[model samples]
Target: MRTRTRIAPVALAAVLVAGGTMLAAGQAGAAPKAGPAVKATCYGGAKYYTSTAGGGSSNAHWPATGTWAYTTSNCNDINVKSDVSLSVKVCFKKTGSCNGWTSAKAGVWTVVAKDVLHGSGFYLQFNRTSSSKGWIAY
Candidate 1:
């Protein structure tokens, strides 16, 4: 014959309490959840300028010359706005190499940057089929 073993209510209560305490302790000793990293803002204030019909802003003059503005510590993209629809791009170095033009609508924040390499320096150029005005933030 098999003998039946039963846990008393008091003993069962102790087991549950101990198990809960162990679980709580383990969780407390675990590492805390990490927070998201903050993105770097533009190094300075936004730049405002005007583009004449079929013309563009002067080459790579913002962020000052010889300075890298889109590195790890700097901005990777820029925010742009305009009074009328326009095109924007990043022109780098003396070769006049540029990223594809990104279209920006009137009064909207359009973030632009592409094919950006670390340590590469660039400036914003705004183009319009007609005269246009805009401001850009790195």
Candidate 2:
């Protein structure tokens, strides 16, 4: 009887080990995950804004959140590009004050590399204006 009991325990252990091994092997064959698409065009980020009558002030207009702002602006300009276009909300004085902030649809500041401009980057922003394309880095 003791011999029989010992043999049963040994058999049960072997079966449990085999089952565990099979479960581990099955884990390796799980499904693969997906991701974002690859871009065929050169990448250049920009911000777009809708024109506002007031913005905030006569010269400088700062639009509050959810406000219809100015048109899309290119930050690559040298002449105060950072202060006007995009999500530009220039304080009449300090940075915290939303004094004269021009509202924009979306603000995107893209960095265009020299090589990228010649290739895929060219296609990203073909509709941009010459004034929009500036040497300044915003």
Candidate 3:
């Protein structure tokens, strides 16, 4: 023969509430916090740019126009957009030695490339080969 023990309703409710509170507290502490914003600096005519540093994306310049060059310290997503015809060249190891290039026609946003960065740095050359327009990167 076997006997079973049942928990009282009040006791079960208390246990559940305690477990839920513990879980809620743990979740609250585990939540990620937002950090300070990164600032991007640009040279040449390029209007917007973003670069990766310390394994995080930083140095973001927005509303960029004309030709510009950007760099990244690690493998991070590089996004580019334009309101006019534009072309981009990606350099894996160095800026001068380009690995690939892509172009966007008319006024449209293009992803350009994704996670093509290296530890040393990857260079992006955005050439606004058309009318006056603006672009952004992240």
Clashes of each: 0, 22, 3
Alpha-carbon local distance difference test for all models: 0.59, 0.31, 0.46
| TM-score against native, each model | 0.45, 0.25, 0.36
Regions of model 1 farther than 4 Å from truth: 1-40, 52-74, 114-120
Q: How many angstroms is residue 12 displaced in model 3 relative to the true structure, after the best TM-score fit? A: 22
Model 3 has an lDDT value of: 0.46
Estimate the lDDT of model 1: 0.59
What stretches of model 3 exceed 4 Å from their correct place?
A: 1-75, 92-96, 118-123, 126-133
Using lDDT, rank the candidates from best to worst. 1, 3, 2
lDDT tens string, model 1, 1-138?
Answer: 122234566678889999999998786665233111122234245568555344244442344445435433334556677777767787776456877788888897677774355565566666544556677655
What is the per-residue lDDT of model 3 for residues 34-94, given as tens digits with 9 covering 90 to 100? 1111213211222453322111332222223233444343213454555556566555445
Residue pairs in collision within model 3: 47-64, 47-65, 48-64
C-alpha RMSD between model 2 and the true structure: 16.1
What lDDT would candidate 2 get against the real structure?
Answer: 0.31
Give the distance in Å from residue 125's predicted Cα in candidate 3 to where it truly belongs. 3.2
RMSD of each: 10.6, 16.1, 12.2
